[model samples]
Target chain A: MQERLYSAPGCTSEERFGEASAAGETLGERMRRSLEQDIARGDLAPGARLDEKEIAERFGVSRTPVREAFRLLAANGLVELRGRQGAIVREIGVNQLLEMFQVMAELEGLCARLAARRITPAQRAMMSDIHARLEAMGEENDPARFYQINLEFHEVIYEASRNDFLAEQTRSLRNRVGAYRLRVTYLPERVRHTLKEHAEVMEAIFAHDAERAHAAMRAHLTLLGDDLIDFIAQFGKE
Target chain B: MQERLYSAPGCTSEERFGEASAAGETLGERMRRSLEQDIARGDLAPGARLDEKEIAERFGVSRTPVREAFRLLAANGLVELRGRQGAIVREIGVNQLLEMFQVMAELEGLCARLAARRITPAQRAMMSDIHARLEAMGEENDPARFYQINLEFHEVIYEASRNDFLAEQTRSLRNRVGAYRLRVTYLPERVRHTLKEHAEVMEAIFAHDAERAHAAMRAHLTLLGDDLIDFIAQFGKE
Candidate 1:
């Protein structure tokens, strides 16, 4: 399989361009979304410099908004801003990637524990739907599609936990660490294993066994961690 | 007990101004430091608009660095960047404040659990020293000094955990929720209660009981939730 630059899949450039036409929004926020979409879609690369003027021209805005977008990115740890230096996209290392997965596991474990006790019927229905979609994709194994559904599956678990703050934070950290997850798509077996793990997690959650669900989620993330290390070793730049 | 603007008790304009010039850091980093100091010291109110030009002029730099600084702040969630509306400091309601403390409790609990297994002799000694200082202040009740030392006590726990990612994430979240933590101070008897809680947490960590340490930390943060609610009712903006 050929390696491609990762970008957020659902958001297209056309939609991003149309974002500039909206009113009452700061240029910073609009450009931030557009740029995040760009990064998500693999249009941008790690360590790439973000030229404020160039981006401003592209977005039909002043340097102010483009500059503001850069700041938001920097805050998110997506980019690094140097004093006299310009902003550059940050790259992830294997160690940092593993650390992120470890934290993600803990958070997922927490969500499962909460969801087991708190999940509503509607949320459980959503979880079932997402799990079904994810399970359907397991045989075909389209990495991107599987990943998307997988995200939804975990998100439903977070929502079922009935803790908005926990959900928001888990989502934010997930976004912050997206680069690493996307880069690990080269491992075919990883996809298969992840699908199997998701099945187990769903079963545990569905049974309302909080401890089992938490353990399953933790084990799933740990598997991702092991696969991530292998991918990074092969692909990581020195 | 007078309610005034959110300025540090001892910080004059000079001391606040000195933070920007004290180090030979880059413009962006220096500005970030200055802004954080202001926020921590209570000079910048939540929902306050940060005008780029004005901030640039204040720090004797161009809008470039100030804008970069804003991005750093936004990343930490100290401010929100509305697309065209400009950046405003974020405000947390009582429920949101409780959410933050709940997450804080979990993260700190994780830290203590790890620290129990990993803490070194030097780190243990440092923690003991910090606790002794906090204990000494129990009678004097010096809020400012106590607060500073209290921070150090938590820092040692995080560091002892020996996970860079978890420590950094926790520290960042703690700062992001700084305003709310400050609000909790106005609650009656909170200071005394907090000191007592700190001692219990320290004792657990010292005894190397991971579960006990985790429980103590969680209980401490739970009390903080009550204090924060009282503060919101008494002084929070409508």
Candidate 2:
């Protein structure tokens, strides 16, 4: 295969390099991630056709890999492939989003329960460190940095659960529902309240209080779900 | 693109029709389902190379579709794409299988819990019918029919949960771990025991006992995990 040139004039050298690294990953893996990012970033409009040749050319790969990527994306419910019409990005509906958030709450609750029981001392300390950084970051009111810290906080709970399969499935669900989650980040009260919930979750985990931890996680997830519902109702009126 | 002929002389008419239907399904979807079924049937041996051209020819489709199929399979962790080295079927060992079963149990538990609260009369009737059919199949000692009925029983529980995201995720995980599950069917006692456990789960769900249903589901899933572990220890020494 010839070296495929990817020419997006607006992309910085670093952004191009990142895209290249992403594309250069195993075709299937790269394709899945690329499509996900595109959907998340709103590059691929919902209901837009994802032609194999077009995607392949854009990603500088053969149709083989692109097809595989589409398959993965379709299975994730991100796309719908009709018999002969080709694949289209799926527009997730409100009910499905709510259902996803419900399950996410249960999984996070389980994670917190398990983390309270099994997280190591080192893991506990790491959670503390992340919480401290988040506190510092919150004082500065950097939404982006707070978001990064927020991911780390939840990731600690997931890792501490000691269930690889659960962690992986949860991550995938989070990714699939990421676009709508972006709305929740913009709310000032949501940000402050989320930080407080993170602290409570961390405290419960550190104290090894299983029920408390589970409750905390459940509360946090419920708050997120409620906020998302409100956010969508107010803005995502499609 | 030229449509390839599947003219293998020994293939039967129904087999041909089946093949055509499978092939005629969107190439990507065909590849995804074929790979999934092949893995479930243990047709594609673990660590097996999933040659793009070989699959393309076998499915009577272009490599484009074949590659797309591999991507979905890889996403489900059935295959691993090694960059330029191509893709290989993943060989899940005992520990990983155990981990998967652990997570499966939690998800199923969640399903039962939700089903207990949300199951309608019609859905409850469906569960009863499935359980009755499974019981009758168990009496006949027909493993294949019993297995099919068993899937219906769980799927009923999934629907009763009324959470599409949870139901879909459970279905996908169930498929990914199915190859190992096929081993449990060989144990005669296992079938009878699973049937009895299904009764307990159904009874709990019928009574609208959320906690009891959740507990029953967890107990049933634990047995599955134990049985799979034992089966792997004795027969799956890979």
Candidate 3:
């Protein structure tokens, strides 16, 4: 795991290069998504200075939309815009990151519990399909593919929970934690471990054991001991 | 409890018209806070229409800043922007509201659990002081005072949790839920009930019982049986 840097697994179209994704989004939205993918992929490293003029030129857009893109990124908690200091990709503080993971574990636990109780047959089938694909892909998975599919796997659970508001809140927080979580996909063994953990969560849900599902999901997401150390290690230089 | 509607208990400085609150907030931000208060107080009821020209005139500003204010309101989940049909005060669907409350319960539970373990002397004192004030206020509590102090009480727990990320997320969701929860403050007996629930939560926190604190807080926020019935009833003419 130390020898490997996390990337995509069994990946396809990890970055939605062209889809507007939502109504009313403009050039700023496209630029934000593109820049987000770059930052998530480590092409734009954490704490790296963001030159607005350079970005404008790179995106082949005017400074106005570029500024809007920066604002949106800041709102998403991916970038920091200091009054005089301009903007930079945010490198989350260790304490803030730990707090985020803690909250994430709890929210995932909630989703798993709801999903266990409410999942429909179709949703269950989809989750099973994704679970099987993850296992079947084995060594061929790319960090990009892994991230996209893993997101889909979780989306199924969120949908199965039949709680749109909860799902939206969970997804919003996940986006804020995106870059770091994506890094885990590059760790080959971590992906394998994640597969096993997902199996445990899936089993609990399949058994209609809400408490067990919640516990399994919480255990899967909570970092302790060596896991926490690995996260701190992967977090780049300040 | 049915005859008693919620309101304030020993409140002061319910609305801060004088303070800018934060730097860089302009006329648009000021308008946002004002309108938010109006909506929360039921001066602007859910499902009410918001006319851009009318609001611009009322706020003594140009339509430009008013539009920006509307955008901010929509972002806060207090307003719905409907293209050429114009904006309306958002009346959240029952299902979405239930989902929001569910997530809110989980988040508050997480805070309570953490606060139980990490609360410092200062935070503990602040919480106790607020609890005493709420209890001491008796029948004198107004809706505004009740809302304000209750916020302070929760803020102490959030601070005590030593998890800024979780606190920020919880606060953001609370803001989105403000209009609805403020209505709860107007239910007089609900405030009394809340005081009892807060006492339970405080006891668990003070005793350093993490699991009990978590359960207490979750129980405090969760609407159950007739509580849910009353919430729907008080949701107003929607």
Candidate 4:
């Protein structure tokens, strides 16, 4: 994955070299992480074939670990393993992506609904703090930092829902679409829109308005989905 | 797996012998199906250790297939593979079950909402047809058959959503909590309530009222979850 960092224009050379030297992870784990990150970043395009021998050689490891990593990726819906052809990154078509977003909207809405009713004072405060941090990132036009903080903001709500299973499922679904979602986050208008949406969700939860919280969260996700579709239509052509 | 059938008084001796003679499925596939059914029926019991050697002997198959079946069950979240301790029927505590039901309600509601908006005339007719069959089963007071048909009825709505990904995820989550759901389906009153709830959802869809359809489905699932918890508390004493 560090090797692929050089391909990403956003990363500084110093950062790339620093990451290259970090090698604490096991071979199979590193392979899995690298493959996942590449797929998520569209560095490795959808439907691209991943030859085990090629990946092994690139990572300077044996084919055995690469095969194991493929299994992990397959289990996570990141790749498809063809019998004779080996592995290819799973291609989520527009319709499927829309379907996923629809489900994701509902899941996030459910979390906000529960969080509104069940969130403690401390959790509510944490949400406010995260919201403030997000606003600061937005003002600075730092999408990269804002994107990371945006995840933390959502994580607070997931935790506030107080349902471990629901939180885990929601997070898993989020990860499934994480790659496509990353593209939308780079837009300045989207960052501004997200700040307002987050504020509405936080206010509803603070007021313990479950229905309002649910509606706000649903609206936020629906807008995000629409934005992604629009982005894909206009920018994806290139 | 066949040996466990003898312990279920619901099965006739003739039926048991008939099943014993059937051999179309591969050993591993048969074992997987049998174990899945047993878990869904609660015959295997939560937290019960699945000794591969014992299960292999009982199913008259080698441990290799039994091991393969374990992998299948683990993938489906039916069993947990604790390190060194081997496999155990996954124990979904009360909190986890509630969380699952909450998410299930949202997923079902999302399906109903989409089905209401996007269902074709043919799909609406199919839903009405399934509802009629469900009503007949309810009148006959056949809980077992009602349970089976009930699944078909919900499946119609899932497909009508026109989102394969959402439908598949909803079905997977349903299967995850199926064992507990089976218990609630046995109650005569619960069956009647389900009939009424199905009518509401079908009516809403037929009317093309997305909000109503969503609300009806969510209410139905929420009621089912509450009833399951109540039943577990009162009758699970044994």
Candidate 1, residues B1-238: lDDT per residue as tens digits? 1122656767654355555464446667677877876776567877678888877776677988777777778777677777656677776665666767777778888888878878999999999898888777666756667668878989999999888888998897787777666655533377678778878887888788988988898888877777666666777655
Each model's Cα RMSD:
4.1, 5.6, 5.7, 5.3
Task: Provide the DockQ value for model 1.
Answer: 0.51
C-alpha RMSD in Å of predicted model 1 compared with the true structure: 4.1
**For this target, which candidate reaches the highest DockQ against the unseen true structure?**
1
List candidate 3 stretches off by more than 4 Å. Answer: A1-38, A41-43, A51-65, A224-228, A234-238, B1-18, B21-35, B49-72, B84-86, B224-228, B234-238
Mind giving the per-residue lDDT tens digits that candidate 4 earns over A39-119? 776667777788888777767778866876776677667888765568888888887888899999999999999999999
Q: Score residue B2 of candidate 3 by CA lDDT.
A: 10
- Order of all candidates by lDDT, from best down to worst? 4, 2, 3, 1
Q: How high is each candidate's interface RMSD, in Å?
A: 2.6, 2.3, 2.6, 5.0
Question: If you superpose only chain B onto the true chain B, what TM-score does each candidate give?
Answer: 0.88, 0.88, 0.82, 0.83
**What are the TM-scores, per candidate, against the unseen true structure?**
0.85, 0.85, 0.84, 0.84
Clashes of each: 15, 2, 29, 0
> Which has the better TM-score: candidate 2, or candidate 3?
2
lDDT of 2 by residue, B1-238 (tens): 2221222234432243247565446656656776677676566667777777866776667887677667668778888877777888888978788888877888899899999999999998888888887776656765556666788889999999999889988898888887767667558888778878889998999899999999899999999998887787787585
- The sequence of per-residue lDDT tens digits that candidate 1 reaches over residues A1-238 is 1123554546565466675566776557778887776665566777677787776776677888777777677767787777657887777556676777777777878788778888888988887788777667666847777667877888888888877888888887788777557657436676667777878887887788988987898898887777776766676654
Model 4: which docking level applies? acceptable
Candidate 1 vs 4: which has more lDDT? 4
Error of model 4, residue A216, in angstroms: 0.7
